[model samples]
Target: MLSPRAGAPPPSCPRAHSTYALAQLHAALAKSGLSTGSATPATAAAAARACARLGHLRAGRAVHGASAKLALLPASALLPNALLHMYASCPGDHYHLQLARLLFDTMPARDAASYNILLTALAVGGHVDEALELFEDMEDAGMAPNEVTVVAVLAACADVGDMDLGRKVHSYAKRQGYCGNVLVCNAAIDMYVKCGCVDAARAVFDGMGDRTTVVTRSSMICGHAMHGEGDKALELFAAMRRQGVRPNGVTFVGLLHACSHMGLVDEGRAFFESMEKDHGIAPAIEHYGCMVDLLSRAGRLHEALEFINGMPMEPNSIVWGALLGGARLHRNVEVGEEAIQRLAVLDPGNDGYYVVLSNIYADAGRWEDVARVRRGMKLRGVKKTRGWSTVSVDGTVHEFTAGDCAHPQATAICDTLDGLLDEARRRGYVPDTSVVLLDMDDAEKERVLARHSEKLAVAFGLMTTPPGTTLRVMKNLRVCRDCHAVMKLISEIAGREIVVRDRNRFHCFKNGVCSCRDYW
Candidate 1:
């Protein structure tokens, strides 16, 4: 019998013809073996997009392997761009930058989207310099930077306080009409704010032709609050609300932080409640932190502890730290002990908790307990972190460690510290030596308490900064009670504002009054 023609189908319904065609196509692909091995560029691109959508790394890698086998993956600009996005969106994957960089270097045709992706990855990854470098490279390559590029570059500038670079980027953005983009404008505003250039930040905020987003408003509020401008922050918040922009979680965080900084306990509480009531925003852990800070500042230690215990979610180290701090502020040894215990269990390897516990015990005159805790610490091999401070003066950043005598101005710093102590004593600054937990004589304890990092930073601030200018110091640890008292005296006697940013919160001293109200 004569064989049927190649295109002819078996004696079946006409609808079966389509299925026959599909089978032939599959057979052809299987004969080529390309489908089973490496994926073609078209297939890789599609797979990359699908992997990104599903967030399936294993499948993505398999597709990538297939592409590599065919040499059809990431060889083209569009395909690599898609792959770059896939890598960038993977959480905790820092190698995205390397991939992005490689793809960016090898791409024969670069687009604004690719450049923006790489720049954003760099900025968010804390590689500000690399972001700037990429921006410069993009400009050199004659690729007109788009709105996304402007925002990414501005964010990088903001992170490092590169005002010169920021100004350049701002000018470029304004020229490119990117200044109208809310995201670009917000990044500009945030950059200025974080760079300690509040005036610049305000200028950008005011010049915004469009309405600000909640994130932009929150950034402005937080910038003002952090720089000791609570009233300004509140004003911005009010303006944001009046403009019909709903405040988000970050907005509430900024508002509550502003109130906490200014010791506005009632206002802070109202904002905290309104987060859920008026704004319909659930309070996050940071919000709870703000509340704990507020109550602690107000000397409502019992209330703060209760609030922490009543949290809807499991408390983290931050909450426990705040609770421990509040206990120390109120001298509630029992609460402090409880917080310390919980903290130890929560973070077994953290040495700060142990040190704070010892300090609390020492503050409460529980010498035996302090000794026992110290013994336990030694047995567990828990070593306390050494305190350090960084002071920037005259374009030089000076670092000091606890009991450090390595600075070129060490002698002057020590003498100035002695003078400050004498002046403080004259002004009724009694040293609370109880913070030193070592089993030593009273004189030795006094000496140990005298050399705390906060004291060192304050002394350096007094000796260096102008007579009436505010002293801004940052410490890596909490300020001891004795040092806190001395700072209050120094602020009054020297007739200057003293701002200390410790590990916990900002402590402002003016005229013998700390912004914490002796609560923290």
Candidate 2:
């Protein structure tokens, strides 16, 4: 057992190159008695920070155990908070997150820094609602939030498209004099964009004035690209260049995405070629994925295949999935089969690739192949991911699944949807029953399509909000063809703007036309 001693110097934390470096640090600490009773609160805190930065979980836990045995908790709160921060900093580790939470709960005293660390961990770990709740508790307990708190909450808002809460937080940050804070401003910009409010994001970007960095510019370009405003994205990039702001790898990714979504084939190829030559940025996997998407979406499946085969690195799921997505869109059975063959090796359990391939076969009238795919999925126990959509009314987010009837206003929502569908049908809106992959009759298929998650969310929005209020719907998967058409009809018939953010991109429907212009 270690005995209490005076103090030891903090371990040196050079820029860690590998786990071997971390192991060396651990060994030095132990050899110098820094990991024993000689560890002071200051030394422990510094060591914890180093571990956090280097993502050395094992070393951090050892520090924690040593601190506990030395009765470090009673000496200073700083050490405990540092330990909490260390655990919270490790991403994709649920055990560390729980340890952080437990440390926070058991801490005798807490501060804003403590709260911020846990809040960030919760938001990044996909426990968004819990993060929001913790923020509320922090406010209730009079723990005034710092800039980090605002950023974490904004991240949660973006994740669920909680625009109402996001706006409230934005307003609070503005009043709290955080407007000049670049990090908070960037988070707000991202939140607005994710919530399908591109104008709001642009406003934030413009408000930054001279303070806008490469990150700010990149967010705006990506936002516009996501909203299918490819011209605006390209225009911004040109302006950025004129201003002498060199684009980074992220900026090129957004630019390439804009080109892909807008069907600018030659422009995309040029940007891909210029990335390394002009910008000195090597083509990363994401950039390669964007290029494949550009080619595939433009019905150049063969070219996309050749590009994938020639990739410097082995093609990952994203590259192959891009080709598969294009195959599904263009109904190229041959390319779809090729992509699936690759994806099966890379990610066989991904139900999405299987479903897409099945749909491609169904579209080609190859019923036997479709049946074979279904049988394989059943044998593999791979379940299709159910589609869902969420609409925020007031400050609450309401979620709906396909044929969902769980909401409190389910009856009224269904009645409203029926009326809207009837009106749309009268206005030349025919349900594309071919999108329904199930072996049901035409009428049944139409019924199924009518009750899609986005339609339900739209109906709920119409019933709950004022007539002119723009409805924002967030979907978990790609919007089907039938739902996309219905959105257009509803926007025109109801005389309201509808914004739907699906898995791929945003669709803004207004006056019987979509921003994507049927290209997406």
Candidate 3:
């Protein structure tokens, strides 16, 4: 396999003889200056691969410049593919992301691996739309996709909430005879679940044949928890036990989350205990966070506090935030104050904690305390992140923020909201003005609540989509009490399923009943 034409060393250079051995090649590059400007494309490819393996981003970028300047980039697809991978694998932040795409777009030629590498980089960097476009380009070029390509594309589909595109990718995978491939199946399961098709996800899981692994099982568990099917998730866990498939930390994370979402207080405690006793897996911070949320949501705020105080390790903001959220829900000012004190020490600049504490005081009619909290907020110069929502329909994603009245279809959406308001009154939709926290009039509070991002997105979904089409909305924040109530009534009136994925979990509304069961 050693050919000097392809950068394989002659009898003299032993370390650089094997292109597959990146460690030895890295040593060869440093010891022999193999990345000379006059080096062939093949030599540079090997050097770039070595740099990638050694995490030498500076050297790799220099190799990239030489490859372009020496006109070695167009010598063969192999070198460019290697260069593409080098840029993608380099250690950097957003700069690496930008460089990866720039290299991808400028490649003289590309194969399936070229697309796969860039797609993976984009997917990991949260560029779902660009990854999907690259996937389409690969298809348009008539390049056959392999298992890795399909997996990355499926992950991108999941992140973008493109159920329609996911189905097509699943079909293509099957056609390519990748139905039995574990990697493809796992990605398919994850994609389907994230796209709000849990049934389809389960079907792929069941049909993966003998290729199942802990990853696949964990994905199934996560899907069930995400869609509010906690019972099914628990049942799947039981099945995993019977099958003797050892559950790992991720499996337990999904289990605890399912229990929390379902309000299964006793079950959550039991699982948390068993993780150490039966499974021998010590609880991680995430697990502790889940337990805190479970206990708090179960109305055991004092127990949650005790649990945090008794933790073997220091409690993080997630744990305190869970307790604070529970206190907010139950209007427990004492616990809220304790949480605020701890949060001020742990995360002093988080405006959210102050807002939650202020709202708690407002709920109790302690306007002066609320005023104090606001003053502290201003003095500390902490600002809350604006809430935003997105609804994807017909391959286009529409975004709405709090007080957003500038969308293209604002008139129709507002009209729909007005109609919902009329129906909301008849259906007993009272604005929970306590959430306002500010000393404002009832009308202003009502307007603010109505213009909330989730409501606007849902209204836009109803206005733009066909009747009976399920509306899928996503929020950057948790659904408030008033909006959650209005969504249920809107589902009943519209006679359409409304699936809202919030910061915490999913809420599916049909016939005035939500999948969260009014807990989350």
Candidate 4:
């Protein structure tokens, strides 16, 4: 809650003493006779800046308590702003924003810099709603926002996925001539992309002038690649290079992602090699994961395994997970065994990967191995996440979890789901019982799979939306194999395009084919 003031006073900055404050905090803290009473605002500000930069919360709080005891913050805007920033930059697990907000509320008078620092802290510190609330309060206090303010507010909007408000902020920036600011423009593009409107991001990117930098190129490329627009991402890369801008590691990460999504295995490898050879960028683990995923999804499991073994660094869980996923798809037991063995050593007791391995075993008719996996899970006390789906209708999201028939329309939704399942079975749609990993026949597993969250959500979608409407679903977990098989049939039977966005990526089921080509 912000209290309004008629106006705020000017900033009272202390003498700039420590330009090298961050690199020298340890030295200062190790000095003799640095008592709190004798400490000036400059010394405290520099120390707090060091603590904030280095993420030293306990030391920072020690300084904060001293400032409060010395009664220095109420007299100077600069000291209070430093404290506000210090608290805000404290780790989120510590809930630092609460203290930041307290400092903000008790400030004697807040200038634009005070508000700006607090705004940025809240936004980056995971207090998105509070940041927006403070922004509104700043405007209500008759303070016109500068570019910094708009960018911070826009980031908060993006974090909360408020595209409507983000657009309004963009409009305000344009009206204030702050849209031309390169950093602001980049934030706007990032905001749109994060809000699931790559088109809007493209609009912002195309509207930019000569101030675009490498960051701008990476953002645009990532936006296009994220939306399954591989060609567009590559085109942007070419344009970026044509303008004499060197691509960084992130640019190739996006490029590799685009190639992986589109199944351009050759191009993916080429871009990967080009990154190190031409761009002088060594591959990070994420880039290696992309290449592994690229090879695995294209049914090159042997080559993918070789690539993993030949890596310069030890493969992490993500890299092994890619191979495990490919093994699941191809039911190559040997590769799955190798990847799982490595993953078990690296990231032991990870339930998701273990489940995938169990599913692979069941698919290959290795019931003994599946039983061993179940025993391992029981020993490790790891349980699979219950799948959940969220369907938004009329601006309200209705959530349903597997085996949770708790909603008002649960009975009707289940009944409709039953009908759909019966029709699909009659049309030769077999259930993927391998995904269940239960000690039962396919028929028994089919009964269990019917109750997965996505089915109930699809049934609800059919009941609520009119005929021929595209049903969009967002699932909290990965879409299981049975649910995916059912979704493919539902799209054909219902004569509607169904889009299900899961944890990994989007699955657009149209005319019996998923956009991912069933790789995921």
RMSD of each: 9.3, 4.3, 5.2, 7.4
Worst 10 residues of 3 by lDDT: 8-17
* TM-scores vs. true structure, each candidate: 0.68, 0.88, 0.90, 0.76
- Best candidate according to lDDT: 2
Write model 4 residue lDDT over 1-520, tens digit each, in one string: 1111112211221122343643355554433113536666666776677666655555566777776777767777877787777776642533577777877898888887778877877776677878888887887887777887788888888666566667778998999999879989999998877665677799889888677889998988987776677799999999988888999988988998889888999999999999879989999999999999899888899999899889999899999999998888788889999999998888886888888888888888888999899789888888876778877565456789987779999899999999998898888888877787778877788888999988888889999988987776778678887898899998888998887767776677888887666555
Residues 1-520 of candidate 1: C-alpha lDDT, one tens digit per residue: 1111333432211122354544543343333334566446665566666555544444444455556677774466667777777666552456545665775677777787788777777777778878888888888877777776688788888665565677788999989888878888899888776655666788988887467677878888987776667899999888877888888888888888788777899999999988888988999999998888778766788888889889999888888877777677667788788888888788877888878777778777788988888788888888878788765555445678877788888888888888888878887777676777777888887777777777777788778877886665667788777888888888888888777767655677889888666644
For residue 215, give model 2's deviation from the true position in Å.
Answer: 1.8
Q: Candidates' lDDT values, in order? A: 0.73, 0.88, 0.83, 0.79
lDDT of 4 at 276: 77
lDDT of 1 at 374: 79
Between candidates 2 and 3, the lDDT winner = 2
- TM-score, candidate number 1: 0.68
Clash totals for all candidate models: 1, 0, 0, 0
- Candidate 2, 16-63: lDDT as tens digits: 346565555564455534544687877778777766766666667777
Error of 3 at 118 (Å): 1.4
Where does candidate 4 stray beyond 4 Å? 1-80, 91-95, 104-119, 126-177, 209-211, 391-398, 412-430, 441-444, 455-472, 485-499, 509-513
